[model samples]
Target chain A: MAVPPTTSRTAAELATQPACWRRAADAVPATEGLPRPGERVAVTGCGTSWFMAQAYAALREAAGEGETDAFAASEFPTARRYDRVVAITRSGTTTEVLDLLAALRGTAPLLALTADPATPVRDAADALAVLDWADEESVVQTRFATTALALLRAALPGGREAVLRAADEAATAVAEPLPAALLSASQWSFLGRGWAYGVAQEAALKMREAAGAWTEAYPSMEYRHGPVAIAGAGRVTWAFGPVPGGLEEAVTAAGGTFVHAPSDPLAELVRAQRVAVAVAEARGLDPDRPRGLTRSVVLGV
Target chain B: MAVPPTTSRTAAELATQPACWRRAADAVPATEGLPRPGERVAVTGCGTSWFMAQAYAALREAAGEGETDAFAASEFPTARRYDRVVAITRSGTTTEVLDLLAALRGTAPLLALTADPATPVRDAADALAVLDWADEESVVQTRFATTALALLRAALPGGREAVLRAADEAATAVAEPLPAALLSASQWSFLGRGWAYGVAQEAALKMREAAGAWTEAYPSMEYRHGPVAIAGAGRVTWAFGPVPGGLEEAVTAAGGTFVHAPSDPLAELVRAQRVAVAVAEARGLDPDRPRGLTRSVVLGV
Candidate 1:
């Protein structure tokens, strides 16, 4: 039997993130469907998109924009009122997203950010921000999720400059090699603080989705409570943004490799994506088509 | 050199769950600080407590009691207004809980559930529910967290009957021995839908804390997306509450051990707690004192 293609589409998609993010950042003004400064907002999605919603919610709230909440689409609180509700879906056809949008139609203004503008989400949403260029061929999503978030970040105060800088860093992150020791670690734990906690969760998800790695994620401060027990000589503890005070020492004392890079968390996530692909390749697995996964989930209710 | 006591306090405390739950159910009437029906609520905690908050939040919303949200104490959206905010901490002195309570003092009504009534949280919260009898000697929490949730559950409509039935089932769960293959599994994945997702997260945390095991948790339907790639011959996939359609078949097809007990999720959680202790005992690790963990976290700001 012949081996399949060596170059995964996930790798190709991941490599294009820096460029996609740059375009997303530049496209923010035209993407006017996002929540405004003082609007109470709820963001919803599924899987990786849900994780990105969490990151945006934390970032939006921390930036003093307004009260922002993120929820998994299936678990969204329908009774709650928000000034605006934003749904993020790479594929506009996800059942949960469509159902939620239909349920929320006349209640509040509904906005959706999707890679496909030609789907039912466009009709469901009152307004739409489409990033068709960021769509992926891989079952494992990489660029679309981050690109959507980049667009959201750009719309915030002081976010545009930061995102532009991070886009450059992401290019470097994709080109540079992942730490060999981390790639070979027996287990991986990702940690983040504030908005970065969402980044950490997404990074861990990327590793599991793209590489089938044994990975976990938690808030940096919560690591010492119990999750740190899993840290050992062959494990990796990667912090997405600023390491909480004394966390590096604790990870080192637990005999685990502590990794922190002075770059935007979004850029750090790009690095983690690269590592996931590299590790998957090393294990003779294709990152593009992860085992038993699809580009979009359309469940029959 | 002498090895300390082999019997774990966590094991002993876990065994007391059924009784503690009964007491909690009976005590719910006196627990005046719980959120009223139709009130928007936010629950906050750290570590094990946070997972319980997630479960309670899901249950509360699912019951149509109100829109309830749960957050790790540090991540609570202070800018958001809720009819009430509930903080759960086994030890009342956790810095994040104290800080959050202090921040929310004049904003709205604050309630706290803690095992230790004497701590500063007593003053920080506007109202308090103390369960001193449920306190634990073990650094790894078991009964105290579940017992607190039991009290919350009992306060909800029809929750008393459910709790009573679950208590009876919990007694059976604690007595039944966990599967030998599951106890020896190399990796574990826990899945739950809705409120059970929080139980799944807590179960995974218990395994990581008590046994230093590699564990992961996800919403049951979302498990097939990518995380199931980690499932294999030596891995375990345990589901709390009803197994989602096709999930059992998927897990079996992946060559992973599939575990689902037809019992209350809270009762299932008790079983998971037992599994954590059993795995710890097999590994010759002390569940009472997980490596580098304390009963409570008090960080200096």
Candidate 2:
């Protein structure tokens, strides 16, 4: 069987995540472009990058680090003044990010984390932190997004230890084969709490991108509100982080498989990434170049 | 054939939206609990209410009223100081809203809009705006949520005219039958731009709640980045507002039905609500009592 390029490339990139996370943690001090402890900040990105921004913003705010807001690049409120604006783009050339950075030039300090330092984002941003080592050959991003998140997480108080521990767990998680039932499930719902809500959204996006799978995500507490109606036999409800009391029982009663492993939320995301690749291979799809998608969206201005 | 109580109630409530909206618009002066023109505000809610909060926040900020943020009630950053915090809950007894209001009791002026003024939220809030007439007997909310939004929109500059126009369009929308193809589509993607993104998200939630349909929502521009991969035959892509350049062509190219009608975005949402009910009736599901859900979540403290 010919292994698709996307499968092999995505797997290889995912496997390097532990080391990438460690490097990102170590590089935090040199990366002065990140937001200061008390600075009000807005983080913008596209696709997977935007989801990571959401996680970082939630985490930063939860840590009492000051106000941090996340927005899809196109939706960033230019009228709002922030102490700093951080852009996360692996390709470093997403049209919206560049346009936003250009528009905000001289108005506020701008920082960007990208895998490609050679791209125009280097010029658009006032400062840049390049994670070239985490760059992927596949169009479906994995290492770069996680590594960028790891870099941001490390900047938070006590985040270094958490990132290191999560990296170690991710190393183990990437090795374990995805559950057959999970891969074969007719539908999936990824649930999370706090910062992990963004992780859940990204996990759902990964499944849709890599395998065209039917997937949904929601804040754990909000799942029972309406989304649970879709939960039943042949569906999987995967939770990241601790869930509200009785959630597991509720999912079970609804006839859905409830998956909650004792791992860091970020580590659980790594496992989800692995499942996406496995499902893609199983479905005979090329995740590296998903249908009707490009690595970077550089629309004509 | 006897109509399910949920369907009939939901339909009746949805049909009253035009009147509800008009009343809300007229009551803008009496709605003293709403955010002021330049006040930095945070709006919080859960489930359907949260989506409406999102729509209102975007609309408020876009109208250049002030910096507005929307958060799920459970995730609101208590540490951040806001000039005002607006809580939306039809039942007025959702535990998260009550807890949040309690937490911010002395810190910031808190406003709550609820259909049930008799509930605990009335006491928890610093001020209250009651939309008792918009309350629903059905577990699945339709009128109350949109009516609350209409109330907020009316407070914005020039919003009265827009609301009146949308209310008129909604009246026509509720009377029209849903598209045959939309009712039968195996999957659906609701897309929106700017403030309408929240409407799309709400529409997708409505489908999941009312019909247990597989649905997704995304910012219209971001859909092509990865989500469009899921678009294909038997799927529908429904846009709430004017789509970005080339989006319709892209959805069609991916073999999905692209739905865009010339109507106010809020009016378009009324059409979506009608479709959800129709689809639920076709699937023999009682939308008003969706599985594993309640009208409001009141977790024990």
Candidate 3:
């Protein structure tokens, strides 16, 4: 095999992948079966996909609509009981995920979310959701992560559609070009609030994977504790949501730069996604067609 | 300032430093200022110290005692609320942690856990618990990390005397040395159970900070998720506790080498400390005194 040289891709192309995500989201209806309000729902996956599952679980818990727990794919079924399993994998071919899906085959309903609809993980799942919006080059995930999150948002009932629309609109607002303040800074620390804590984690992981950069994520409050000392002049911080003003203030007070995504209708999450894509590009790693990595795992595990 | 040559130190010496940890056992009086059951306790430190605090918090939470939360010093009081603060610092002087202590400024009872008691953190704290064990000379912390955790075990109620006794026994047990399998492995992963999850996190962080190695920490069960797919015959897993037979069997079946710690009294954590210390030494770093580091901070941020 030849060694592949590095490359880049566009987040816009990746965002348009809702058609693929739609297929995966549609499968949820059948594969989701019927989960009781209190039924135990176990969500698992790897890398950013795992973080997405975690975010979904947090949102569900916060909404008070479901009994959900998130676990690393390797740690599932080790403790407690589950009535349903939701596995998110962009590649649809994660080996450990397949192993877990196999174990849950008879034990509970299995829902697999991925960008590659035909991968083994999808095949093993009773239902599949794919956020097919992805770049061909970058090994680290970007648009697919957001689209998958959007699909998760779409799955909720009631005001969820509103949130989805908000997220979509927010995405549009921030996508064209990140403000110079957010894009020009040398470093970033992503802070998430409550249900969005998992989002912060996923953002950090994505930054590391796609950009090979050192980015730290913490609960909004935790940042104020000690990390604030490092927030000197010119440091850039992206605050995830509005709950933790103390954290943002700490960064700003440190003579550092701050970008607060005003609580516009779905503006916060969308702004986060757009800024992340911009950061990916600023690091000289293309958001489109990133280097030496792929969107799917077709090779056997 | 003159540049000093990097020298190696033994794990035991590095771990036993008074400045590196707080021997909260009988070392401190359970006076009025001492934390009571259910009182919110905030643990803060930076980098490796923060990881140790995280492990301690997890353990206390698992033990069903202590209202515990851990934070990177930078995110402390600015992020969360606490009645009592436990600050861990190998070098009694992490700028962020010290700044955190200063910020708290008599707001809550403060306990400084450090290798050096004379440092400003200790001098300013309401009380202090010193490890004075395992002095090392490396920029990367080894023995100090484990010893600090041992000190945390002693601080929790109920098993102080017993756990302290076990620490002595366990410290002696550290004599067995790391397993041969570990010595030969090019890459290693750490897994912890229950509160030990923090240990796994610390181990992974140390690997990165000291050796610039690629490592990860996860709950024992989480490993079976997607990462296990990447596991093969050559992978070495250092499990942090006596996992259930079934979980241990799964790890073995995955074709990765599995090393289990004794559970009779939670021997995994002790052994892990020794393994980490030994590895640091093997890498030609000192377990006693790594490099470019110290046990206390007095005049700096």
Query: How do the residues A163-245 of candidate 2 rate in per-residue lDDT, one tens digit apiece?
Result: 99999999999776677778778888999988899999989998998889999999998887789888899999999998888
**Each model's TM-score?**
0.95, 0.96, 0.58
Q: Model 2 clash pairs?
A: none
Q: Worst 10-residue stretch by lDDT in candidate 1 chain B?
A: B1-10
Better model by lDDT, 1 or 2?
2
Model 2, C-alpha of B215: deviation from truth (Å)? 0.5
Q: Is candidate 2 or candidate 3 better by TM-score?
A: 2
Expressed as tens digits, the lDDT of each residue in A63-175 for candidate 1 is 99998888888778788899999999989999878989999999989999999999999899999999999998888888999998999988999999988999999999977
Model 3 error, position B223 (Å): 11
- Model 3 TM-score is 0.58
RMSD of 1: 3.4
Q: Report the number of the highest-TM-score candidate.
A: 2
Considering every candidate listed, which one attains the maximal lDDT? 2
Candidate 3 lDDT over residue span A144-243, tens digit each = 6655655665566643454545555554664455567765565567777655667777655555444434455666655543344345555667777664
